[model samples]
Each structure stands twice: as structure tokens, then as C-alpha cells.
Target: MNWKKAMTATVAISTCALLMSSTIWAHGYIEQPASRAYKGSNALGLNTNVGSAQYEPQSIEALKGYPSAGPTDGHIASGGVAGFGPLDDQTSTRWHKTDIKTGALKVQWKLTAQHATASWKYYITKQGWNPNEPLKRSTLQEIAVINDKGAKPAANVSHTINIPSDRSGYHVILGVWDISDTANAFYQVIDVNITGQGTGGTTPTTPTDPGQPSANAWSPSMIYVGGDTVSYDGKTYRAKWWTSGEMPGHSDVWELLAGLQ
Candidate 1:
């Protein structure tokens, strides 16, 4: 072939190769309620950028043997992958959380590339589980499991799961999407506040000024020092020490104040 024709042919082949590579790397992640990796309303007004490419970067293979098997205690939130350690950081202490009322909750996932899904399992932190520590299998209790079994999930797959009616306060919901054909599974961790309300529950109260503590639910990302106060789940708290990531109701860093009722 002539030199010009040969160059054109080479360019076409390269383009095809790039497209094929992108296709092979397609994977899924939780979108609604905003998984740690997803970007949208849940991420608004946060001081830190939760949309880190390293958290679940494209082309990164999923971790295998989840829940009981893969992803040791320290990396549980990040699916036992490198470069995602920040998601599990206990010191950074601030992750955006979605405020939800207790009851049937609909969770959704966005698949950049769809694969035959084996199943989707969701686990939430047990009531009273310490949020100041890294996530572990022991810290979570399985809440729902849906078996897809080789079914091709839509671009936006959704599942409705019941949240415990009695539980309240900040929690993490970990989602695992097991691939039917591959030995990998996609993992997503979502922060949520469970207010004691059934369906059509009361909306979360807007946050008040940073200087004045309002009835607004506490967020992990907010920094608190000695004497700083906040309200969570209808209870008020006074910080005893400098802390973050410690849920107001669950951590020792904050002391619940009496006579607030």
C-alpha cells in the first residue's frame, strides 16, 4: 500500500483499539444517595472533593470474595483497592452524608458499562457501631440481597430495601455488585442519616449557621472543637475535644448535654 494509505489504515486501527479498551473497562457504581464515588447533589457544599478518580477509577478491576472474603478490615470502604484508602480514613472524618428518614429506601446504581450481574448485596453499619474507626465486615449487618444471576442490569439499576425503623443517626451502607462472569465485584459505600420516620417522613431540617447549633442533623465532615455543639436525631451534643468523622450520637468525642429537651 502507498505511504499515505498505510498511515490512514494505522490511524483507523488505533481508534478501534481505543474504543475496544474503553468498552472492556466499563463498570458499575452506586449513584443515588451518592456513593462515595458518585458526583451530584449529595456532594454539594462539601469542603473536600469526594469525586476522586483514585477511589474507583475506570479500568480498575473489582475486588473478589466480598463481605466474608475480600477487602480486609482497613480497606472495606474502598473495596480493598489501593489509592482508595482515603475513603476509609478515620482521621479525615468528614464524608458527605445523605439524610434519610427510616423506612423503605430506594437505592440506585449507574453502570457506565453493564455486565451480567450475579447479585447486589447491601449492608449497613449496625446500630451503635463506631463511625470513628475504619469500616469492617463486623461493623456492618447485611440488610438486603438481590440475586440477579447473570441478568443484564439496566444503565440505572434500582433496588428498594427496608431500613430498620428503630435505628436513628449517622450510618454507612455498603453495596456490593457481584459480576456473574468475572471474579470481581464492585463496592460502594454511602453515608446516610436515618431519622425515625416512615414513608413520606419529615424532610431533614436545613443546617443553621456554623456558630449556632440548630436542630439540623450532624455531618461527619463538619469540624468540631471543644464546646462546639450540634443537634442530631433530635438530641443536642457538646464537643469535649477536637474531632471529626465521629457521629454525634455514636462517638465519645462529643458529650450529650442534658436539659436540652
Candidate 2:
């Protein structure tokens, strides 16, 4: 071929390659606000650790539908918090997982706007807890922040966290500080989705679920009491309600939530 023709062809191929790469990169990302709140019994959840040596364990909890308030937000119920805080300084909640390969690092939950302060803390250990001190509370490594100022049912917000290479297995603690003088604030925890962060370098194993169909898919949708159904395109699917471990952050059992859709 003539030089002019060859050069034209090269440019066209390069442009197409560049476009394809950008599309792939843009498509991969973890999204919060999991599609559909969990259904079935209240006993379904999962746990994930943060940082370098991160890992996860499966378990179960009897989660009622996503917490709601006087009114409603979207399909979920709504409520407000004034001046309420945890009775015990040390507290615990469920865990959500993310795939670093996909560059996914967003965490979200439901809460009321009345609460003035919303924050996400991370930790390898519980805060304010001490063997000698009866009031020793558990300590957590603070990683991200959330803003919930009103009591909107399913009011949602998200934040990015710092996961140190050395820190393994991370969980998000959703807390609401005092609102006005009442100091009573309310928060709800539900579908948390981790996407995009799978190691792009390796061949990932598709997640699987037994009772459910094998080819399920997930979208930017959420299910409250009745799960939002989707298809799973990965390997190794497991589900359960995770809890505080017998050890600091360890647990057993995969309660067989639902297969990935």
C-alpha cells in the first residue's frame, strides 16, 4: 500500500483502541446504594476487612426491612434523629466488600437529615474498650465521612475511604452525632454495593449462588424488603449476615444469602 494509505489506516486503528480503553476504564467502578434492599428473613449479610491484608467472613442477622421513619423516601420509609447517640460508646455494624481491581471505593447508607453529623470510621479494633476500665470503648480507624442533616427516609450519601496497603479487612461504621440540642439522631443501614475494584491484572472467578440462577445480573437498582433481582456474571457467590467476631474481626458461616445476579 502507498505511504499515505498506510498512515491513514494506522491512525484509525489507534483512535479506536483509545476509545475502547477509555470506555472500559469508565465502566468499572463500585457503586453504593445496592440494588434493592435485602429480602428473605432478616438473617442475611456479609463482612469485609480494609487495608493490605483485608479478608471477609460470612454470617447471619435478622434484618428487618431497611429502617424507615414517619414518611418515606423513594420506596423506603423515612425518619429523623434529634439528640440520640449509642448507649454504649463502643458499637458494631455489618460489613460490605469491594474489589480493588475495579477502582471501586464508594460506601453509602440510609439516614435522616435531622442528624447533624454523619461519619464513617474504620478500625482493626474496637474503640474505648479496655480490660481494666469497665467503660473502655472500642477504637476504629477513621477513613471516610458522610453528611445527613435531615430525616429523609432512605436519605443516601457516600464517601471515599483510605485503605492502607498494610491494613487488611475493613468495615464501615455508620454513626450519627447529635442534631440540634435533642442529640437524638437516627440512621439506617442497608444494601451497600462494592463494584469495579477487581484486580484488572488477573482472571477473576465469577461469583456463584446455588439456590438462585447462575446467570444473574445487577444494575443501579436497589431492593428494600423484597430483594431486587439481577444476574450474576462472576464466580464464587456466597451470602450471609456478618457480625462481630469471636476474635476481633473474624467469623464463620456463609448463610447462603442469594446468588449473584
Candidate 3:
């Protein structure tokens, strides 16, 4: 092959390699106070089935506009990506909550790859939002927002977020690391114990009844007969008929029984 032809072939291969690596090596996640991805990661010696998220915690990269455009309501935790689906599973008991007090708290990010930053926004769940419910824009209120004006961030990016004093129990803090160089942004959810106590910052009893809201998770392969009930994303649903494989909320086979608890 001629020199120019060989150079073109080499460039094509390098471009393909770069694109593939970008998709896999995602960028960053909260490190201190343990974001969900870090809490259940294999590298941390933490053992929890978070799918690929356990292996690649920094990869929760998603679209940029968070409250308005990005990864819709029910899929915030996983950055609306299918590979990190386990992060979307909602349950107060499912994730490890970090003990935190309201006021000035330092949150740190573990960046595997740094990019030109647009902004770093922090939002906390609304005062009464259910811990078991999937995170939504309506359920969260912004606590802090910082823009770098498209400057590349340092290797270690830490922010001092002043949590609202009125919060209590288990609350999720959604952090969006906006990348100025790209259309995507990285997301991380920090399950914080506002009162710095137990799982909820207060002792709470586990519900015994399977019928209780969020007591049982919906499994796609599990067959359900008419009148059968189950929970998904903190909502209770009743099977309108013998249904299997179809998911609740997304299908007509399941009827909405009740809202989040």
C-alpha cells in the first residue's frame, strides 16, 4: 500500500478505537460519602450486583439538561443507560445510605477521565419525597449549581454543598457533572442519612405484608394472574389479567393501584 493509503487506514482504526473507549471508560462519580456506584463497586471490595456499574461506576454518563431534558424521570440514577439498569432499581433498603448532617458538607468526585466542564449542579430530594420512589425532577430541588464556563476541571473535583436544614430521614442527592466539550453529562446519586442515624436516620420497621407498597419488586419473567399485585418504582400495581414478561406502568396489563408510599 502507498504511504497515504496506509496513513488513512491507521487513522480510521485509531478513530474507531477512541470512540469505543469513550463509550466504555465514562468519566466521573461522587467518591466521598459513597455514591451508589461506588458503594456497590467491585473495585472497592463492595459486593452488590449493580451490573456493569459495579465495574464502571464513573460511567453513569447521560444527556446534559437534567431537570428539563436529560435522562427522564424514572431513569435518573442510571443516567438513562441500559447497561446501568440496576442503579434504577428503587428501594429504601436496596442502597447503602451515607450518614450526613445538614449544612456544609464536602462532596468529592472520582474522575476516571476529565473533560471541559460546563457546570456541576447539586439537587436534593424534596422534603416529602418517598425514599423508595424513583428519582424525578419534580421530587428534587436544587441546592447548588456551579459553572466553569467551559474550563477543564482538575483531576480531583470537590464541592461544598450546603444541604438544607429542613431535610430528615433518607434523601437522595443527584449530582450532574456537565461536560462542555460533549453533549453528555455524568450523574451520581448520594443516598444521605440527614439525621446521621440508621438506614433512615431513625429506626424504621420493615413491613411484613407482601401487599404493602414497595414491599416486593416486580420481576419481568414472573407470571401474574388476575388480581395479583406487585410494586415497581415505589408504585403498587394490580394485574388486570394473567400477565408475564410485560412490565408494570409501561403496559396496560397492569393497572395502577396506588402511588408511591
- True-structure lDDT of candidate 2: 0.27
**Lowest lDDT block of 10, candidate 3:** 199-208
Superposition-based RMSD of candidate 2 using all C-alpha atoms, in angstroms: 23.2
Worst 10 residues of 1 by lDDT: 200-209
Count of clashes, each model: 2, 86, 0
Could you say which candidate leads in lDDT? 3
Across 170-197, the per-residue lDDT of candidate 3 in tens digits comes to 8999999988888999999988788842
Worst 10 residues of 2 by lDDT: 52-61
Cα lDDT of candidate 3 equals 0.77
Best by TM-score, which number? 3
What is the TM-score of candidate 2?
Answer: 0.27
Ranking by lDDT: 3, 1, 2
Pairs that collide, model 1: 65-70, 94-221
Which TM-score value belongs to model 1?
0.63
Q: TM-score of every model?
A: 0.63, 0.27, 0.67
